[model samples]
Target: MNNTPESSFERCPVCQGSGSLRHLVTIREVPYWRCERCQCTLMDARCRLSPDDEQEVYRLHDNQPEDPGYRRFLNKLAGPLLARLAPGSEGLDFGCGPGPALAMMLREAGMQVRLFDPLFYPNHGALAGQYEFVTCTEVVEHLHHPLETFSLLDRLLKPGGLLGVMTCFQTDDSRFANWHYRRDPTHVVFYREATLQWLADHFGWVLEIPAKDVAIFRKPLSQPPVPGNG
Candidate 1:
């Protein structure tokens, strides 16, 4: 039932909107982009990952936080985030991918972790519960409608919840041209700190940039003012 039309967003033709561009290197062509707002290099848009294609890739990954290497990598976000969570926190791993590694780590930390991934864990019912935290590790870059996804993540949060995200930010134009991260066709939309700031401003949430590749946004305990209301 992968009904997403291939041309829904027109493939961001100029940079191909692959969100990366290709550079002619001495040995091989390199892919990257030059962000208009941030002036950072990135990848040029390529043929997108069809829903079927994305699912295929997920089927191949095997990771769990119990794996020492996995834990070591995840703790980069988990340590700081764990410190912020209250005991018995209930949370969701929005894009758990194949192994649900982060959920495993969160559960290990005593939080009740619910997992969701459109392709693998399709228990849509989990979305019904409110969470004190939501983590989308390396997931936002693949989002087609980041605003829509963020809104849903926001709605799924109880007041004062933390939304933790991890994805490399565009830093220097020099590196983007050959950055290995862009090789994955699934990654699309790139984010700048300002992008997160814009989201925080509009939603009335507080934003924090703890790691170079991670962001944590906190939803205020009170509801944000209704749109267009003074």
Candidate 2:
């Protein structure tokens, strides 16, 4: 008896209930699933962890403060972002986690970096206004509401400001159940390249896939496009 109420998890929380499954993909023999509704790949709802359960899991993470490899990985976006930004660019590290390595990196680059994480930093005020740049590396998948969150981010940046994101895109017709990402219950929403485009169009921003798992959207000061992009 699969009495588990799917609605209890909220209707396709990723796409605000309107989003539907687009396709599925496999990563390392593990199956992954995506919603066409939001073009988001996700672990099924049954895999979800309660709030307390997730917090306990996070406590177990040992993200080293000085990991060169991690820095190098983050550089996929940071490198290009630094190039686009001037010194003193105001930046926000949404979902900075307990160890905010991303925020530190931007601060090191002479940017004014603020952090907001529901648990660790927990400063909703950081989203109150515009920013020169905003980074959500390895964060979007954790969102229970991609539509709302992304829209908020779009509004948070000044026209011509930058929004950076990093999350593996879900592919089509492949392995899913064994995907390592799905093993983590905290990751709820999945994304696709087309999904980003949907966002670009919806928000009137420029979207770029600078590297695999790395996405950037820039808002233009000019009039919005009839066929918007992101």
Give, for candidate 2, the lowest lDDT window spanning 10 residues.
Answer: 2-11
Q: Could you give candidate 1's per-residue lDDT for residues 40-95 as a string of tens digits?
A: 33333454567889768767777865689987787778877899999889999998
- Model 2, C-alpha of 41: deviation from truth (Å): 2.5
Best by lDDT: 2
lDDT of 2 by residue, 181-212 (tens): 66676777767788888778777788988888
lDDT of 2: 0.75
Q: Give the winner by TM-score.
A: 2
Q: Candidates' TM-scores? A: 0.79, 0.83
| 10 residues in a row with least lDDT, candidate 1 | 21-30
| lDDT scores in order | 0.70, 0.75
